[model samples]
Target chain A: MITFDDVVKVYPGGSTAVDHLSLELPTGKTTVFVGPSGCGKTTSLRMINRMINPTSGRILIDGQDVAGQDDALLRRKIGYVIQHAGLFPHRTVLDNVATVPMLLGKSRKEARTAALGLLERVGLSAEFASRYPAQLSGGQQQRVGVARALAADPPVMLMDEPFSAVDPVVREGLHREFLRLQKDLGKTIAMVTHDIDEAIKLGDVVVILRQGGKLAQIGTPQELLDHPADEFVAEFVGRDRGLRSLSFDTAAGLPVRPLTADLLLDEAGRPVSWGDGEPTGGTFTVEDSLRLVTDLAITSPVGIAVRVDANGKADGLVPHHDLVDHLAERRAAK
Target chain B: MNLSYLFDAAHWSLTADGSIPQLILSHVWYVVLALIIGTIIALPVGLYIGHTGRGSFLAINAGNAGRSLPTLGLLMLMVTLLGLGLTPVLIALTVLVIPPILTSAYAGMRTLDHRVVDAARGMGMRPWQVLFKVELPMALPVMMSGFRSAALQVVATATVAAAVGLNGLGRLLIDGLAVNDYSRVLAGAIVVAVLAVVLDLILALAQRWIVSPGLR
Candidate 1:
């Protein structure tokens, strides 16, 4: 866990970057700091490792003050990933990932061995190990950056818009991989980004900051979406936040009706088409999100979503009106 | 132009003091010594300035000043003050070598992607480690180009040593001119030009070997 104890950062010329901000990033979870430009999200992230020291107040990592620790030693213990990956252009990918371990006194052979496994874990092949950062594309380089950060197995990770530099398609892939890696490692991660949709997708706890580095609100993604603190946050989360919140809930408990005769099925019991051999829009399983189920239902020509089982066999149906009723019931229960 | 002097076996003799072989050796000796002295004096200063961004004014202006100062005039002035010997010629040649090396080192450090340095620091590398492990290796291409130019300049200019009673390939030119033997003078000029090109080629090969292929 990291705690900011009334931290303030005023630049030498008297411009305030962070204004007496106090917050706690919980252990073993991802906390996202998000806001517009000049909100000090990046500044606050840098202060954790003393890259930019706070003007006043202390930042503590697991109850120990970062100010008292040596800069290099403290930084070594905290993994950091930035927008462009910031790789050493001269070093091969293997050596780049091996940097932290080698700096911490591991032998070159040992470090390289560990680095090979890390590259694989990050979805890079052994062929890429000998290649330099320039030989790889933007998305590939970012993976190497992540691999390098994890080389020392640091308990805390700081990310500053790590996925922002890539194209949208590559960013989506990276986001999925990142979540999977985080699920397994569970490092105490603090990331900063300006995109609220990203904050909603990745953050366990979202910290919204105002223009002057002041905290606007701090809560879970659903909490922030459902109950914004003010007009700024409401506008920031966007107008369709209610629809977006459906992503968090699954369609498991929603009632489904028996499949009708018009729904055609293959020999293996999979839904192949609707009435008159017209193809089915799509199929959703019980594990799928409410959002996916709602989308399927609304888009289906016959106004019903096919519910499939784990084996892809059509089992039940969810009509559009039933989804509305289910949503209304959920609101009443809330 | 009498070409007969260059073809004479007596002038090519290894044992003779003023023969082509002996003159080439002396010429190489002057170029090597001047380069060694100049690098020893300039490389560290250049690296320091580049690494710290201090003394930038000195780095920027030193190259122009060093280039503009006439080597012949400096050698004559040194000879007048210190008496005629190898010292004055060496001092002049070493002066000619410093500017390129120092300026190149500074430019190399300045042009580095700052983000790479930031990543290095953030990865827990000590200041010296960052210099040796990251900055120095990356800056080699620029530093080497500077060193090559310095060597080329020193090779071409070391001929001035013959003006101060020093034995080198320059002797062929100075002695030839004194006796009106155009063949010997032409031979000296050709040898010096060839030596410069050969030295530059060797340095280019060295740079290719040392610098990371990734940069290319």
Candidate 2:
């Protein structure tokens, strides 16, 4: 667990960058610090690694004061990722990932072997091992950044807008892959971002800060979305938070209607285009979030979402009207 | 305007004093020593100022002072003070070599992507490690160009050493002029220009070989 005990960062010019802020970030969970520009979210994230020192107050990891440890030794025990990857342009992809391991005194060959495995884990192929960072696309370079951070397998990871530099489509893919990796690894993580949607999607605890480094609010993504502490948070989370909250709800318990003759199918029992030759609406599995289910229902020409089994065959359908009723009941219950 | 002295076998002979081969070797030697000494002095100072962001004014002013100093005047002054010898010539030439190297090293380190440096620091690299492993490697292309410019300046200016009775390529120009050996003067001018071009080309090749292809 990481604890910030009334930490305050004031620059030499007498301007406070981070106010007397206090918070606790739990272990094995992802906590995101999010705010507008100059809100001290990045400042707070950087303080964990001592990149930005707090003018006063203490930052502790597992009840030990971080200020007491040697700076380099303290940093080596944590993983850090930043926007644009911040990779060494002179090093090959393999060597870049191997850096921290080598710094910790691992032999070159051993570090490289471990780095290759990390490359694959972060969705890179063996072919990318020898290429320089410039040779890879922006998304590919970000993946390498992640691989490099995970090289030492530190118990904690600090990310400063790690995927913000990539395009939205690539960012989504990275988000999915990142969550999958986190699920498997369960490392204590602290991330900073300005994107509310990203914070909701990835953070177990979302910390919203306002200008002057003051805390605006702190809660789960659902709590923040369901009931923002004030107008500022509501505005910050964006105007569509009600619709976005549906993302956390699973569609598994929703009612599904039996498939009708109007539903078109192919020889393999999969949904196909209607006779008009246009493609049928997108499919939603039982495990998909309600947001996707609602999208599938709204877009279907026949007013029903095709529910596909594991084999991609149509199992059932969710009528558009039924989704509306379920969402209404869910909101009323809250 | 006569150029026959360049092709004349007597000028080319190693045994003759002020021969093309002898003059060329002496000229190259002066350039090499000045560059080595200048770099040894300037490189570390530039890097230290750049890395710490301290004494930047010193780096900037040093470069401007180097560019403005009159090389021939400095050589004559040094010769008067230190007496006619290699010391006066070398001292003058070495001054010309300092600015480019110092300024380039400082500029190269200053302009690197700070994000990369931050990442290096955040990843637990000691300050010295960051300087050597990250900053120096990235700054090499710019620093090398600085070195090249310094070398070229040293090569062209070493000829001024002949004013103080030093034996170098400049001797051809000084002696030829005294005896009205216009052909020898032309030959000296031609050889010096060619040497400058060849040295610059070698430096360019060295830069290409030393710099990581990833940077390109």
On TM-score, the leading prediction is 1
| Candidate 2 C-alpha lDDT tens digits along B29-110 | 9999999999999999999998889999999999999999999999989888988889988889989999999999999999
After superposition, candidate 1 runs with Cα above 4 Å error: none
DockQ of predicted candidate 2: 0.81
Clashing pairs in 1: none
Q: TM-score (0 to 1) for chain A, all models?
A: 0.98, 0.92
Question: Which lDDT values do the candidates have, in the order given?
Answer: 0.93, 0.93
Q: Give Cα distance to truth, residue A329, candidate 2, Å.
A: 2.6
Query: What is the Cα-based lDDT of residue B1 in candidate 2?
Result: 70
Clashing pairs in 2: none
Encode model 1's per-residue lDDT on A210-284: one tens digit a residue: 998999999999999878999999999999998898898899899999989999888999998997876679999
Candidate 2 lDDT over residue span A166-269, tens digit each: 99999999999999999999999999999988999999999999999999999999999999999999999999898899888888889888887766798999
